[model samples]
Target: MNKLTLLLFWLMPICLYCQEDYDFDALLDSTSVLSEQGAYEQCFQILGDLRQYLRENPDKEKLFFLNIHEAYDYTRFGYYSKAECLFKESIQLAKELGDKWNEAYAWYGLGYVTQDKVLSNSSLPPSEEGKRAFFEAIELLKAEGDSAFLVDAYDAQGYAFFLEGKFSEAIEYGEMALELCLKLNDCESEPNILSNLSEYYLAIDDFSTGKKHLQASLKWIKEHPGEIADEIAYNVYRNQADILIHEGKIAEGEQLAMKVLEYAMEHKDPYLLRETNKMLIDYAAARGDYEKAFQLQQTFMSQLDSLHEMQLVLSHDRNQTLLNIGLRDKEYQLLGAKLYSQRVITWSAVGLIVLLLGLLSTVFILNRQSKQFNAKLKKEVERQTKELRISNEALERFAYVASHDLRTPLRNVISFIGLIQRRLKNHNDADLNSFIQYAKDYANHMNRLLNDILDYSKMGERRLVATPTGIDLNQIMEKVFPMVKDDFREKQGILEVGLLPTVYGDETSLIRLFQNLLENAITYNDKETPLVAVQLHSVANGHAVFCVSDNGIGIDHAYHEKVFEMFTRLHNMEQYPGTGLGLAICKRIVNDMGGEIWMDSSEGAGTSVFFTLPLIEVEHEQQSQENGAKAAMAVA
Candidate 1:
């Protein structure tokens, strides 16, 4: 048995332990059901009772995470500092007990309360400290041979990276998390990973990729469709609505958003209700229905104000920042008096007067400055920052458009030159033969450059002439595999094919994504087994995940971000034998097609590149794919 089970066994009476502690188990189940049914206060009461009972004769080490969960309940009710202190105590207890999983959980709990997971906090250094806790958790799980928990740690690290705005590395660790979870058939881990992947894609403006994950999430919902909790389905609709709005289909999006509000009301989940109302404000505004938006915004503000008023009383001691500022001068002067006892009376009177005057002065100055000088300073900074952001966005737009527009004539010039070279290569003259080779070589070189730019442009200027259709993406890979069969044969590398599912996507982009990733795998090998694997499947969100993995001369982590940029290559042209834009084109097309392109590699062990495509799983596409597959099978 693991430590958790053993600890539970020790906690219960022998008779009760043998019978499985049914009351405790029932309490947990009841709490889950109540929370899912949107009875937060009832669930909160149950949790409190359980924690209180457990704490009365607490097994300090075993109860460490119990308190952590107790703190989670507190945080859900807006008691953030109490939650933070409880989590910190749990972390210390977990460390002393050598329980890394609980330690990691504690760090995650604190982070969640801080809005470090939900909001941008550039003021804080990237929370590498939390990452270290997770790393420790993974190492412990690995030692225990618990791959599932190890996967959770990997995900935790990825979340930390995401919080820090390190998208590429975030994907890398996230990919590792998925790899481990997939191996273990860890069904519970799927929705969480898919949610993160959706967030990542949306950040990069890869709408399809984001939709893909949400799509997979729908299937996961289908897996236990009846047992599905209200919150799960509600989140699915809400996230889909958010994506649809971003994709500029606001009417459809608003309908979906309304569904979320309706669900929240039916369940009476104040938290979900608050979130939905907040979302409705944006959705209503987008629909150019300002009246509804304003109303929703007012409701949201009222909710916050009420909560703030309650918190002011229930959470007085929770403001550590305020307390620290209050206590510092008093503590300093007290220490000074203690060190200089001979002058205590003189120092005491002087300190008292100075402290009173200083307090009044600070209060007055702070109130005055905050109202005027601070507002002006804040406005100026915000204006400058807004201007910079606009300038940056304009530059990115110009680059994308210019690259796209230049590709057409450039493609014609290169194609004509190719024809010229083909004609000249047939000449019989000996001196002309040498000349033909030179012309052919230079033409091909120049053609590669223009082709790279054109392909990259095609990716950036993505306007799907046709929407995605479902394909057995793995079968598509089989077709691509044959084209590169000769290269594999020449290199004597082993290719591994994992279970692949049918995916919906633009065939052209899918083909290019596969081709480039596979090419990278094949070309950059030390030629051992030179193993390459083509893995594909459905993920929780409406996405088809595909990966091309290789055991090769892997890339360093620093270059991972650089690798996606156009013409970014670790090896020189002569050494690598091609334009670096191949991977960049792959990255662009994958991103443009509403997907992500990311790499996972160290210096030598292996590299696995993962990308997701929009799944064809909306209302009507299922029938279309089935008919297409049946007809193709008949032809075969």
Candidate 2:
């Protein structure tokens, strides 16, 4: 009887553990199915239960699974911070357990959450950490020979690059994912990869390639009906519509676009609806249906505002959810502590007192730390606010200066018009004609000033908001040279361009930058045979300095610094006609591109305008190697 009681006592825990393990496995299977079916609430419930079980059983493998699933559940609800914390925990647990597969998944989850966080906050730049995480996950999955998950990782990385405006890189990764998906006969990701490829190609202005990929995506969807989601199908259709419109197949494109609009409306997806309406607006404008375009524009604006409000609400809800989760965790901890204290007190009152004192100490330390953190945060906020105020004051000063400058042209126009009106009664045709021309010139000057001001303001905003890409200076010069070739021809001047390097910048801005400099070089010359030369001045420290030199009526030393100021001219309008905004615009563009521009000249000496641009190192090196090889071949 004694042996039987001892055996049962020992066997009881083993039996319970086995039963618990079985239940855990079943629950995990259920969670997987529920997750696949998009029943995230049920998945979360199971995950919570598993979390509680793990607290008691302490199974590393089961804990990793619980963290991963719960992290994904939180992620789907936009609780990114929670998801990130859970993913990090899973990563650590997976590493401890030497589970490469789950470790790869945990890294992938972390990267995906990071990507989501960046996407949610437009102010944030593309995440390098996210990219590194994805790379780690991909390498591990490759080592594990897990091609299925590898496809997802590749697709995700491609999408991340796409969001960052790295279209070429995006295309490269998308192609890899597509090839793998095709080889594995994985129809699930094929359409998505193809659709994404189309967008990437289109972004780089490879319309034919983009159209081909769009068609392939559509065909894939047609062949694999129900495999693709409704959202994906509509997105593919929208791409097709955009391509067709670009191809001038207006009727067909509009038809497809209308279909997408219907789908968006039916689904009540504000983003899709606004996008479709914008496309329709463009279509209407193209067809010269201004009324329809206006109506669509109104609708698009309304949808945009609604979408912004929805985003705000979603953000608030996510923050609230995080707060509630924290509160619940604290409540659980307090409940557990209370129960522990009760059990300890049952054993010994003295031990209970010690436990209570320890709890109080922890709480006091945490409260003090929280207070310090709050104080630091408050100081940081105040510092930022002061900086913002200074920036705003500077902007106000700029506005005041701009308005003051603008009034000069207006006054000239008014004065000239009054003179013309008074002289009309005197029948003075020559004076009247001269006054009219003067008025026209001032009005034209005002127009030019307004356009330049707009460009300056827009460029500043664009520099802050737009994603820059690799721009070949050679290509930019090709576009810019043609624009100023007429000026060169008229002056009968020689315009020489040296070999240019590729740089990281906005294409349009770069083109404008060169155009302004080249035109300035040609326009400012006083010599009979003006010589304008564009040459690579120097290259060092990942920057290329280019010099645009001109045998012009050079700027005086006294006026060199002032020349870049807005509407500051060295010469009169009659001698050298301009808004004087050229150098100002050039300076703004150079500064915005993280470079400097300055002129080296005396009054009679030829001016050399030197500017720096960030060099695309790989491209510059390749070019140099090619040049070296050519030189060797020439010697041979």
- The worst-scoring run of ten residues by lDDT in candidate 1 lies at 117-126
Model 2 residue 78 distance off true place after TM-score fit, in angstroms: 1.2
Those runs of model 1 whose alpha carbons end farther than 4 Å from true positions after fitting are 1-60, 63-73, 98-132, 160-170, 226-232, 246-249, 262-636
Per-residue lDDT over 120-205 for candidate 2, one digit per residue giving the tens place of the 0 to 100 score: 55333434555588888999999999998999899999988887788888999999999899999855888888898988887787
Residue-by-residue lDDT tens digits, candidate 1, 1-636 = 345334433443332323334456555555555544445544554554455346444677646756666677656544454566787788788888887666666766665655532432112333444336566656666766767767776777787777669988877788788777777874577766776676666667787988998888777877866655567668667778878887788789878887787776555455566756766786678778776675676556555544533443333333332233224323333333333333333445566665867655655555564456445545654664565445434434544565566567657756775676678676777765564454445445545765665565455335436476786665566566666666677787766665556666677777777777777788888865577777653475787777788889889998988888765669864566576778878876777667887878899878888888776643345543554344223222
**Count of residue pairs whose backbone atoms collide, per candidate:** 15, 0
In Å, residue 530's CA in model 1 sits off its true spot by 94
Measured against the true structure, the TM-scores of the candidates, in listed sequence, are 0.36, 0.48
Question: Against the true structure, what is every candidate's RMSD?
Answer: 30.6, 23.7
